[model samples]
Target chain A: MINNFHSLLTIMMTDPTNLLSLGWVDSFIIIVYFIFVLGIGYYLLRFTKTGEDFFMAGRKMTAWIAGLSFVAANLGSLELMGWAASAYQYGILATHWYWIGAIPAMLFLGIIMMPFYYISKTHSVPGYLKLRFGEGSSMLSAVSFGFMTVFMSGINMYSMAIVMKVVLGWDIHFSIWVSSITVMVYVVLGGLLSAIFNEVLQFMLIWLGALIIPIIGLIETGGWDGMVERISQNFPAGDYTHLWSTMGSFQDNPMGIHWTGIVFGLGLIISFAYWTTDFLVVQRVLSAKDLRSAKMAPIIGAGFKMMVPFIVILPGLLGLAVILPPLVGENQVSAMNPHSYNEVLPLMLARYAGPGLLGLGVTALIAGFMSGMAGNVSAFATVWTYDIYKPTHLKLSKKEESDAYYVKIGRWCTVLGVFVSIGTAYLVQQFASIMDYVQALFSFFVAPLFGTVILGMLWKRATAAGGFWGLFAGIGSSIGMWAWVKIYPGALKYIALSEHAKDMAENMYRALWSWLICVIVTVVVSYLTRPKADSELVGLVRGCTDIPSEGDLPLIKRPIFWASIVFAIFIVLNIIFW
Target chain B: MIENKGISIWFFIGSLLLIYGVAITIANVYEMISPSMEKQIVLRELNFGVWWGILLVIVGLIYFINFRPWKKGNNNKN
Candidate 1:
């Protein structure tokens, strides 16, 4: 499962037929792109100050910048490649995950969890937990956040490498190396600031390329009506038509994925944990200019989440229905056995996109992949340096060099993270549903952090002992059940284990179960322990409101941010007929 | 300090309405317009330099733009 997952990840990394296929124009275009990316990173480096600058982009991100960064982080190289693969493999049902899963989840997270965001204004989500619950809880969350990164970064990079090998005809190692080396160059140069700047560009660029293939495909096939007609004729409209159905012959079809699965099961749990609790989203909102900016960033993200179905999921199925028939046989469409649909979307892009614009599209995808890698590298470095390094080791009397050193080491850590994660990606390649594997592993850590942090802020009664024990209980049961589900496939296979099926241990990790168990353990532990001091809760609340007032918000952004989000939401509503 | 409450509230509402309106407009326009009409345009302009394509190219160019680390008057960084 892992090997197949890795192999299929790069299905869209490059075009197999275009091997050694460097045109003068393509070469020029590619060179220009490289110059711009490196240049942007270099320029953004100026924004780096003390450790905060390197780690949190100086906590000065505008809503526009945050929106772009969120979008970029939302997609990695694997996502750019995977959407095509998913669409081709599952028809339109791939989109349902975006609309049903991503859009509503992020929206609810923004509104429902605003109170939590208001209180825990720290660098990483674990840091917020620590602030809320005490040192022990924060430390626990930091460790879990670190673990989650290992799981997610590995899955993402590995999948991207798979696409490069399949699409670009590069050796798997070479793909991994090239991807790592290039992304590291900029990520190391500027840290999170560089990561965000580069990602904004990437988000726009990838979308440009991503949306292009479908429009062109639609043209080649006839149009939207043509697509629907072809889908109706060639495939069951039910499979291709619906966004929330369980279709696809590649893996186990778990029972927990029904309406209950979509809503109460995997959907509810992941949405609550990830949107409300996960530090990645939290980090972006925290970086906002103010409370208004913070709220705006997520609202915008929710809006874009809605468009993803149209932008990502529909194109792949359309590839299978409209474009893939003549160029590649069904055998080739299925690709090398176990039917690796991952590469088909990119392959279809190569097959369909006119040769003139092909280079730009390819370049855009490369940008998208690198941007995601950069986000992980930067994020991991931030947590390691801030939560682990500075807190643990040498203290500088002068804040300047200490800050400068953080800037320096933060960049170095990103480089280290890129290299380590690439290696980790290779290891993660053993799983099948690479995306699911990453998410499930994330869920294990995500929900516990959510539970601990929320309680830490709202309930002064939350205890450090409770925080530690709760984390252990939540994460421990997640991993344990994962092992059980993997070996047995017996009663609990219904879990899909949601994300675990995609990881190194294919078919465990059940996101919902992990969250439930984690919350239960955390609450029970908190209940068992002494209540937290009142002063600590007050401090956490004060910190949340303090920074946003003077530093970032200038009144101008307030309107722009709100406007952008409202627009984004409208886009969401129209796409899924929601 | 800069309490232009009226302006701030107006901008907030205006920005929200515009952004949301645009997002909804594009989506709605796409739906309202015949898919066949879109198909005709998309097919005719496979290689034609549409504004969308041009805009995409321009956006890519912006990513590559190089600025000196300490350019004379770039206050945005601070």
Candidate 2:
């Protein structure tokens, strides 16, 4: 019976094509992580009695907790693996995603935008839209956000399974079922509180597990200077080590992007859009205990976000420098050189980590994926319950539901959302390219929504008609541009405005165009329509709102002070790398 | 974070790290003693498992003691 059980367990868990196998020590650590997260959810269940507690964590998180959770929610395995792969493919140009592409926008959200969001007491980003714009704009935002969140969640699920299959030889079905069920249980039981707690845990686990890669790699390659020398020696055709020196011309860099595209398109539009408007990340800040904590959270997040490249990008650089036989792209992968660029982080992990550390690394990846899915599902539940279901239900029935009733709906939505995501995951598994389109679909909404939200907050003269039409026009134009490129292969030069621009450059330029169209349409429409009264716009718009001072204790205590420090560091890092 | 009144997150992290650290350390030491059972890993000569495990144990102990539930008035609820 014991031998039969052992064989059954092995058959259920392991895949035949796996490149690495975990020892018992590694397996034990993974088991502990699952139990730890589930235990947190189960333990927190009693505290999650009300809708606010379930959906917003009762707004009692400190800056550190909320900050770490905010960063961790975006620090998914997909983000890690994908960016690491990009580092190997495009070199240190990929660091722009973490640095210029992220830090400035994150600081902007904390210092400039958090006041509007916090003072408004909105539950989600669309909730803010309803107050500033109207029901129509809010509904549009909520529906698109809801749909995209679940779709992305499913993609994360599918990606996790694939990673597990490739790295650990786990069966895809087993990986999917186990991880999905685990996420569903915790999320349903405790909701956002559960998600936030797990996110914080995931953040720590990620650092502990993955930080070793860069440390070991640096030791192996002599150090940063040594790694740079080795990488430069290997790829002398293009400057791969310098961040900004080669960005003057598209042909000088591996990414085929101009500095303007990096600065204006990504650094300005895309980064601000995703960081400020996306409810998935903003919801973490909204869980802060007070206005000050809310204001401080993203700044703290920005500081840590700067350091992530060491673990993520450095390993990829090390791979380019030292890994033998070379990692190839998916199309070029074969039985002999089976690893693809997507497998860079895992390949590095397999190279350095032994039994005990191997478990930690795998656990970190699992934690990252599960937390990412949880973030998506929890955001979906909030939007569905608060934005879509509640408003629609009340408008039709003309009755206000109790908070408990909505909390119950939120719980049910969590379950339903998980099931939908699982179904979507299976669907994506059948047609892998669906994942790319799903990610593109996310970009379509975010850039446009940023225009709507920023205009709504900064310009009091912006009317409801303007907000709605601007969002509609922005999304429509983004989709149109995407389809244009799809239909006409030559349209890329027209859209990105340079023949040298690659797919990544095209995405940035497209976001910039969609945002401009949104702003222009909004400006024209707002001038044509009557505006909201200043009294009505008090907490929603910048000029009309009375901003509260966070109170001066010391320069060191202020969010702005830390933000300035982070900004200074940002500029210095850019200059040093330049 | 208020829900953490039952148990602090730090304490939980500490407990898990301590457990893992000790396990890894013991596993590494046993392999060192028995030489034949050790798996070939990169930088194995560095004895990373021993030192890293010890570091984890020390950090974990600090967190575990500081936030342990049984300690007097140890609830670090935000």
Per-prediction TM-score, chain A only?
A: 0.82, 0.97
Give the per-residue lDDT digits (tens) of candidate 1, residues A1-578. Answer: 32333344344335545322332333444455566667766755555656766777666676666765776676776665676665665456455456555665565544445545644557776676656665666676776676667557767767666665555665677667766787788777766766776676666557655676666677666877788777777655344555443523324332223445555543566566666666655565666655565656676776666666666776676766654342332366443342346556555555544332454567667777787677667777878777777666644433334567777777777777776787677666665576566676666676556556555555566677777777777778777776676687663545553332433223223555666666677678777877655555664643333323323657555534454565566555535442
> RMSD, each candidate, Å?
9.3, 1.9
Model 2 regions more than 4 Å off: A1-17, A335-338, B36-38
- lDDT by residue (tens digit), candidate 1, B8-68: 1112222222332233234323433433232122343343323344453344233222222
State the lDDT at B29 in candidate 1: 37
Model 2 C-alpha lDDT per residue in residues A136-220, reported as the tens digit of each score: 9999999999998998888888888887777776778888888889988998888898899889888888888888789888988
DockQ of each: 0.07, 0.59
For each prediction, how big is the interface RMSD? Answer: 12.1, 1.8
Tell me the TM-score of model 2. Answer: 0.97
What's model 2's lDDT at A482? 94
Q: List the lowest-lDDT window of 10 residues for candidate 1 chain A.
A: A247-256
- TM-score, per-candidate, Cα-based: 0.76, 0.97
